[model samples]
Target: MKPIVTLTINPTIDLATAVAEVTPEHKLRCDAERRDPGGGGLNVARVIRELGGESLALYPRGGSTGELLERLLEEKRLRRWPISISGHTRENFTVTERKSGREFRFVMPGPTLTEAEWKTVLDSLSTVAADVEFIVASGSLAPGVPVDFYARVAHIAREQNAKLVLDTSGEPLRAALEEGVFFAKPNRKEFRDMMGPQVDEPAGMAAAARSFLEKGRAEILVVSMGADGAMLTTREGQYRAVPPPVKTASSVGAGDSFVGGMTFGLARGLPPHEAFRWGIASGTAALMSQGTDLCSRQDVEHLLTQVQPTRLA
Candidate 1:
């Protein structure tokens, strides 16, 4: 089987803790904290590994946190292509209030990349893109990285004859779309923001997606709508996947898991709708776990059986 390669321009160490409550001006006690290797692409890579799939995580690392991130990845026995940088990698904090079940996240902007650093990353991607069948570029671009970074990666993927699956938002996504990509997975807010005020309803959303398809910007569009389910459109048809109802632990990383599952299905040669089922399953599974634990292989398989796909006109 061809290898799966994920490119994460910005990665971090995710620290999660449970607190009774978060009240301003009041000191709060918290439970033990858990730390894990994180970032959008890293989450996807971790999910892929949990599913017994092989993936190479390509990202930059620096400072002491970067060392911890490397150690964590080593503990997972996952392969990595580390691009050493001068700046330290950032850290993200997730605080879950056990009583209210509310989760608050504090994300830090990652290390800034220099012109030389960016060129090195691009060169490395040029090499790795050749050996992989799929290149999953998911996450925010750090400062100093051009907005068209993903677009360049998309171009490289095309040159290597590999599929590029993009999971990002805002200008980066819009910029990449201008350059054209194979697939894109954006949540409701990101989609709305990209579509602007013109798209306010479901039909409008569909139309905006169709516009992208018509322009050949993306072959498949997956818009995840949180608890309302997800909308998937392809050249062949469109469908909405409604997952079984369950209590959501933490919404963080769910979207990344969805991308991971969708990529997993595509890698296995599944049809679009079938692949979407896995994507929804993976997302719902991630919701069942607290903090940054993400989705497990067992949860994903079990939830896959409960995912129902409805065709859209």
Candidate 2:
């Protein structure tokens, strides 16, 4: 197996806690807090680390918040390469309502990236792509960055014969799909946004995903439906796995964890079906933790034993 590399263009430092209630124009006393290195790719890298896999995390950062983000990742001992930028890195906040079990997430738009700065990421990928097996680009694009950033990455991945796994949305996601990635993970909403409003139903989703595969947009596509579980589609077959209901602490990192599990499995040459189950397991495990705490290896292994995958094709 070759090395795994993850790129997060708009990563954040996540601060989370529980509050009795949230009301505007009132002082809301919060409970004990937790801080973690965050953003789509960072969370995926953390999940990969928890699963006993190693990955190189690449992102741009600056200012005090950026320093804090770097410190957080350092505490986790994740291998990282941070590109210095002009503006400060952003921080996101998650507040869980103790009474209703609802989580309120306030996401900040990350700093804008200039053409020169964004190009550094591409140059870095060019250097690492040759030795890597998978290049996973997850998370939202920063302001001022081209929506085609990931498409440029897709071309680089192809040049180096590396698989690209995407977990993003909106124009960026749509553009990358046009480039034909190795795999893609789109939640129910993102899938709907791409294929149309009718794609939310399971049958419609399967058809939409199959169409994507047939059109060469993606070799394998996974649609994550919260509560309804997840489904995987490929040229060879389609499979669905439902997670056993468990008390969810926070779903902050579940999607990233799922991506981590899928990459970990595929890198180890596991069968695609089995790898899909691993993704389901990792996602369920993530729900078992609180705040910024992601899935654990132990929980993922235990959850893996209970995954019942059904082939739909």
Candidate 3:
């Protein structure tokens, strides 16, 4: 099988620790500190690897933190295309409480790239495109990068005849949509943010999605609604996939897992609805794990059996 290629313009070192509680004006001590390589596309790659799929992760790296991130990926034995930069990479912190089932996340801004660095990364992608089956561009754009970076990648994917799956938010997502994409995975709030005040109701959300479809901006639009499940809209039809209710352990990385699962299914030529089942199952399965561990093959397989897709009129 050809490898799935994931591009992450902004990547980070995810440091998670346990704390008794998050108290105001106090330093609380905890246990079980863990650090992992993260970022949207990287998380998707992690999920793919866990599911017995092969993927190549590409992203910019810089300084000592970047070195740490690379070492972590090396430990996982994941293939990578690292674009060297000058500034240090960023770290995101997640604090989890064992007794309370609460998690707090602190995200920081990643390194800013120079024009030369940006151009180098794009040039590297052109070379990578020739061998990749799918180009998955996910996550935020770092400073010094244009909002349309993903849009440019979409064009490159088209030129290479490779499918593109985009998972992002706000203006970058809007820009990608304007340039057209193969698929977009947006959570409920992100969809609302992109559509502005227009997506006030469920019907409005559907309408906004239909408008995007009508314009051919995206071949498929998946809106993830957490516990409410997900809504999938495509040119062929619309459908909803709901998973069997399970108590969520932590919501982190669920959406990325969903994108990974959906891309995996689509890469295998599965229909939209069937792909959606895999997506929802992967998402729910990720929610069943702690911290940023994401979904395991067994978790996804068990959840797949309990997922049901309903056609919408």
Top candidate (lDDT)? 2
Clashing pairs in 2: none
**Error of model 2, residue 60, in angstroms:** 0.5
Q: After superposing candidate 2, which stretches have Cα over 4 Å from the reference? A: none
**Model 2 per-residue lDDT tens digits across residues 1-313:** 5668999999998999899988899999999888889999998888888888888999999999999999999999999999999999999999999889999999999999999999998899888898888999999999989999999999999999999999999999999988889999999999899999668577888888898898999988999987788999988899998997788888888899999998899988988888998899999999999888989999999999999899998
Best model per TM-score? 2
Per-candidate TM equals: 0.97, 0.98, 0.96
Residues 1-313, candidate 3: write the lDDT tens digits: 6889999888999998888778888878878678899999999998888877889999999999999999999998899999999989999999997669789999988988998998888888888998877889999899999888888888888888888899999888988888888999999899888776676677777788898799988999999998888999998888887777887878899899999998888887799889899999998899888887888889899989998888775
Off by over 4 Å in 1: 25-27
> Regarding TM-score, does 1 or 2 come out ahead?
2
Per-residue CA lDDT of candidate 1, range 1-313, in tens? Answer: 5778998999999999989889898778888888899988888888888887888999998999999999998998878999999999999999998789888999999999998998899899999888889889999999999999998998898898889999998889988888888889988899888877655688888788888688898999998998888999999888888878878778888899999998988898899899999899999999999888889899999988999899886
In order of listing, the candidates' clash counts read: 0, 0, 0
Q: How many backbone collisions does model 3 have?
A: 0
lDDT of 3: 0.88
C-alpha lDDT values of all predictions: 0.89, 0.91, 0.88
Angstrom error of the Cα, residue 61, model 1: value is 0.5
Error of 1 at 214 (Å): 0.7
Tell me which residue pairs clash in candidate 1.
Answer: none
lDDT of 2 at 153: 93
